[model samples]
Target: MHWHDEIETELQQMKRELKRSTNWNLDHSSDPNIEGLENVLKKLNHLTGLQGVKNEVNTLINFLKIQQLRQKKGLNVMSLTLHSVFCGSPGTGKTTVARMMGEIYRELGILSKGHLVETDRSGLVAGYLGQTAIKVDRLVESALDGVLFIDEAYALAPEGSGNDFGQEAIDTLLKRMEDYRDRLVVIVAGYSNEMSRFINTNPGLQSRFNKYFYFEDYQPEELVSIFEGICQQNDFKLLKESRKHLLAKFSELYIHRDDKFGNGRLVRNIFDQVIEKQANRLVKLPRVDRDKMMVILAEDIPD
Candidate 1:
């Protein structure tokens, strides 16, 4: 059994932990009703790097804490204006961070309920004009009191004056944002330049989204740490040579990440690929020996 497998094995040991429980305490006077949101932030805070981004999240989290206290005191919650523009090269962890934001807001009282409804152009809009509104409304309903994260928001701002359904989707989304100001946090994500254009395309959109955090490409040392961290997380022991090779591979990928995909997006595919290769190699090992199986050799990585 590998360490990565341990995650599943542990979950199996207690199905309830993997699944949220409906057993609310019978006492209505119980204290502190956070729904595992703070627990998630604790884990994220421990991850290395992203100091600047981490600080930004901490500030918002504090604001959320204030809102929670106000709700407990039966006071009106303050309106939120911390929508962000995540700019960076591929594989830098944008989506993962967004998910964490959802959990944080859930912990906070800014949202009546906090969750993330993820989608892109195809996911939000329809082929016809009027149809787009219905599609968008459903998305809004699903994201009620949470976040509706639209990735590649720039696609809505296509070149040359055309009535692509993209514009319809944007229009519907904008109207809903205003209508549902009491609930729902909308986040538009994509390349920095494209995201800027996306905002400028609509004045309403521009005025509302105020926070912007750029995710930089991982440095060589950062890549090494990321690679080693992945190995350790999955309970794979990389030989010193394999560790250097993995680092170099990821560093090369990060260097060329500028063509289109950013760091947060690109690095994950490499992780998945390595895991697949390692798993296949392990499968053929005459017997499943959890102990003797130690090192991942350099040959595990492609030339």
Candidate 2:
């Protein structure tokens, strides 16, 4: 099995160590508790710059609602495919949206647990023969009654490969998905083109994952707003000059962005650097106060 260099071996080890662990990417404790469907939708609407995603999710919710009404009236209801394909680049809110989808699904009476279990090729494929199946089986079992999110899912079917164990993991996962059709949901995510290729890798994948959601990269203003939100959450205040610098920097970044451009992730990294620079400036002062600690100057905003 070919492992992406970016996915550290420690991550693979964690998957084995925490085979029974729940909630891979999203933290339920920090998020607002889902008391009802309205609250769940409110949270979805709060996410930045995903108008298309928000609309599509609303469409699904309405469809499910009508399906429930039809069933109540004893009308024949069409079968629902809980599986989906999330196409996007890194840090474009694919994982966050997937978590919300799980909650929405639960509220609609589609899933039982609605928790999200995340994995990738490294989490499923093993070094030896016959081991991939076991790994996939354990992962699927843990994800029962919930959503199984496979990030960078295209890696499982590497181009021009033979005898790769990733295919075995894919086969096992497909079987488990069917066996738990009523109780489980699966979402495979990656770059748009690669995800399309992944779905076409197997007829089963194409059939089950007919639903697709495309997440566009955040615009310059959206990135700045995301940065501001992060600052508010962290108790940092950006001055007018700092905000101006940020807008220009984000605009430049957006203009020259490539397919692999990190949208929200780039903003987050800039935030980290800004905070570190602010701390360095404060350390040079004779004395510091709460105001100085909270303020982020123009110089703190990196070029």
Candidate that scores best on TM-score: 2
Model 2 earns a TM-score of 0.87
Top-scoring candidate (lDDT) = 2
lDDT values, one for every candidate: 0.70, 0.86
Model 1 off-target regions past 4 Å? 1-38, 63-80, 261-265, 271-294
Least accurate 10 contiguous residues by lDDT in model 2: 20-29
Candidate 1, residues 220-262: lDDT per residue as tens digits?
A: 6776676667767778787788878877777776567554754
How much is 236 displaced in model 1, in angstroms? Answer: 1.5
After superposition, which runs of candidate 2 have C-alpha atoms over 4 Å from their true positions?
A: 1-35
lDDT of 1 at 208: 77
Q: How accurate is candidate 2 locally (lDDT)?
A: 0.86
Task: Give the CA lDDT, 0 to 100, for residue 272 in model 2.
Answer: 98
List pairs with backbone clashes in candidate 2.
none
Clashes of each: 13, 0
